[model samples]
Target: MSQSTDFDLTSSQTAEFDLTTVAFKSNPYPILARLRTHDPVYQYTSSPDGQSTWLITRYEDAEIVLRDERFVKDKQSTLPPEERAPSAGPAPSVSDLFDLGMLKFDPPDHTRLRKVVNLFFTPRATEQWRESVQRISDELIDKVESQKRMDLIEDFASVLPIRIISEMLGVPAEDSMQLHLWTKRIADALDDPAAFEQVASDLQAFYTYLLALVEKKRQASTDDLVCKLMHASVEGDQLTERELVAMIFLLILAGHETTTNLIGNGILALLTHPEQKQLLQAQPELIKPAIEEFLRYLAPFTITTHRWAREDVEMRGKLIRHGDAVLVSLAATNRDENKFDHPDTLDITRQENPHIAFGKGVHYCLGAPLARLEGQIAINTLLRRLPAMQLDIEPEALVWRTGSTVLGVNHLPVTF
Candidate 1:
């Protein structure tokens, strides 16, 4: 990535480049491209709180931030004593619920939490679910096969992962829809900070459900990931009640949400790029690499969760002060001209692809293998079963979900 000695943020550009707006979420590439070229380390101030966050756009800079130890995930540890005081509130905020997960921790603690369930998500272990994933995909398609038309996201993409993860976590089949609703609201809150209060009730209900589930597991163990975690330990250190609840919460939300986007975005890519779609149909062997292409061309998580500067740091001549929020744009880094040739083009058969859609470094997504398995089976089964599948609505008429953290369509209607 080329270094930019001068930073330029015109008043007009600043006004138009607001990241929180629906329009920006719908299409952030053009603006991200401009930032990558001019201000690789741009500072964006939130309109509501006026808190500034440094945005890392270029591939080189993004890699540095992701891998560097100085950019920590736990901001509470680095904040000054005065700023660290807990805010008085009637109930815990949605952000508080999120901070309990492993995603919000650094090594040692993060390592310990991940180690308890790491065996379940390994590449080899994930293969065990291939048949289960295929069966679920077939069953989902069977329901809509005769309908001739269906909302792909609602009827398929979203359902497949939730069912799989629910089963893995030993959650009852009947409760899948309820869990889905809760996770969706939590994701929406993460996307739009303003929606936190609106979704607090749902979040609390979800938390209560998890508490009950944990207690039930304690009395009776089963051969499921959740049960295994309840007994599994590293160096004879077992997970506490709070740790267990947070672990299960993270697994449920991250497991299905990211894969849902993977399947949704992957199918959308194929629908728009006819040639690539045809190529994959003709050569089924390309499904694995095609999934990688989808992750690259349209990353599931556009920008990473906030990482705070442990201390004053300089990158590309920009100063990121201690305790300041830093975010790495995975979407921009994947499309960096310096890394991938013709970065915007969708090429399923491309031989040289190294995208960080699941992210990189210590915090790399643990459910990536499962997500790839689900995407491969879901996309391939859809193509094989409904060979004539096509978008039911005009491409431009589709509405994108608010917020840039996760990239996906709200609903994908399709016809066979």
Candidate 2:
């Protein structure tokens, strides 16, 4: 998109990096690479919010920040009530759901909340859904077979994850579309401070919907993830009403949004890389490894959720003060030449690939197993089912999602 930088600190300091532009969103790798090479720990005032955040780009530095307890998740832990960024937002509003979720919490509180559902998401437990995942994948493909040409994202990629997660949450199929739309709006607000007010209104509505859903599930006591979590207790400590709602909100939002992008982006990667696509097509056994490559090459999330410093900390010759926000660039770390032989090249047969696409340490992705299962099944099945599948539109015509933490194309026109 723009001229590549060779880690020129002077040029970077003089210029401002804009994350809101189409060019940046479409291809942020080049800039990310420059930061990794020239300035591993770069600090910048965000264009949208004007908030300062340290960008940890190098693989070693990112891993250290992600695992280090000194850098806490909930900014409230380190800052005082008024000083902290809303520990629980405001009373009676679901706006605080994010702060309550385990993503934003440090040890003890984070450990307790994450323990509630960790068993269900483990690789062993998630494998039970393999057959069901395969069935869902086939059903989705069957719908688009007659059409021949379809938006791969809407018609297939997006549908599969929402359906799987919706069924897990015991939500009726009819209501999934509404939840998806609301989640998209919430994700949009995450990257665009300008949309905060609108997203707040949407959150209120979503909170109300979840409140009703929880009551219904409680009354029925069905066999689903919601019911299991409702009854789950850790060391005799059950989830409070507010905690329950927040947990469900986190699951629904993270469950589908991340995987939706994973499937959509993975498919796009394979389609664009004909040699790798052909390699997989010729050797179906390479599907699993290929899926990992897809995750590393086209990271579903460009950056990890925000982490705040608990105290003054010095990293990579930069001093990070208390309550400062930090973002780890997973895309940059994944492509670091220090870690991989040929950082930019896509190789399906990559062995012992230590990519942190799902992150590292205590807060690593909980649903990673399920995401991998869905991705492997979805991509392999799509390629096998539609042997001649090809992009029906030019590459330049593609439009990626904007002002969002996640990375994915909005529409992928393809035909078989």
Candidate 3:
């Protein structure tokens, strides 16, 4: 469906757009274009508390918000008195296990914390996992090859990453399913504040699980990533116990969820645009560039993490008050016509694809290389194994996930 005619800007007030709806999640590009053109620095008042969040839609402005030091990620510390959200109190039984990791910190702290895990994500480090990724891909494809039909997300994409992450964390194969359930529930709970009670329960359960796992690793001193993280220190700087668990939790959540979305969204994009699929299948070598295009074209993350202004600032003719929340729409910015030629079109071979799907600057996704590696291997393997695969349901009948920061379908049924 072409969104040019599907959306009417005048139907509702310009700033009334909300991402937590099925309508918005189904097709956000048109609304994104409208926002980019009319109000690059848009403001929307959240209900109940009347909290305001400045949404940066255009490419240039969104990039600025992401990289600029004035815009800090941890709003709890920077937000002004009235702007600050009410205290939700300490973690009841989980302790500080749910605390934000390096992703939420800025400057020296962010730099310090990122260093511990940085080595594991480098291209060289990621390459070490490529063979393992290929084996996992082949195993997954083998399962579906005979079935002829599968729910791609649950049966394939979702399984690959969780398994890999569990192995990396030293979790036994038998316990993988439980870990997957915990992470999935926690990730789903992100946009639903009403799920706080359930979320708290899940967090405590997950925290307790990790605590036991960490202790097991410590007693044995294995070579897994978790064991390495436990022993890692720099210049007399070591992660506190809470930081250690929180970082591991962050790793597992980010490590799998984003890659799962990448694979799910990438396949859906190609399935919807058969020409692109044909092009990729014919050329075969375009998988790398195709990965970039998919990241830009379908941008799994609609917006980057929330940021708050440290002081009053003016940009794009708008005065952002101090402590005001700012969110950059990665999906919108990647599709900004001002930044790319024919931004809406999916050109698998397009060069100069500088999309911020993984974000930018100090906060650029640490697991990006791994995600890309897994994506390339997974998609290529899928196309190679099931060249005749097609969707089992009508495109419009497909449901997009609601009330979630990560944009993906809950289930993608396909047949070959």
TM-score for each of the candidates: 0.94, 0.94, 0.93
Candidate 2's residue-wise lDDT over 356-404, tens digit each?
A: 9899888999999999999889888998999889998887778877664
Candidate 1 clash pair list: none
lDDT of each: 0.85, 0.82, 0.82
Model 2, C-alpha of 383: deviation from truth (Å): 0.7
Tens digits of per-residue lDDT for model 3, 202-293: 78888898888888888899989899888888776777666788888888888878888899999999999999999999988999999999
Error of 3 at 63 (Å): 1.2
lDDT of 1 by residue, 127-153 (tens): 999999999999999999999999999
Prediction 3 global C-alpha lDDT = 0.82
Candidate 3 weakest lDDT stretch, 10 residues: 1-10
Per-structure clash totals for the candidates: 0, 0, 0
Worst 10 residues of 2 by lDDT: 1-10
Residue pairs in candidate 2 whose N, alpha carbon or C atoms collide under 3 angstroms: none
RMSD of each predicted structure: 3.0, 3.0, 3.9
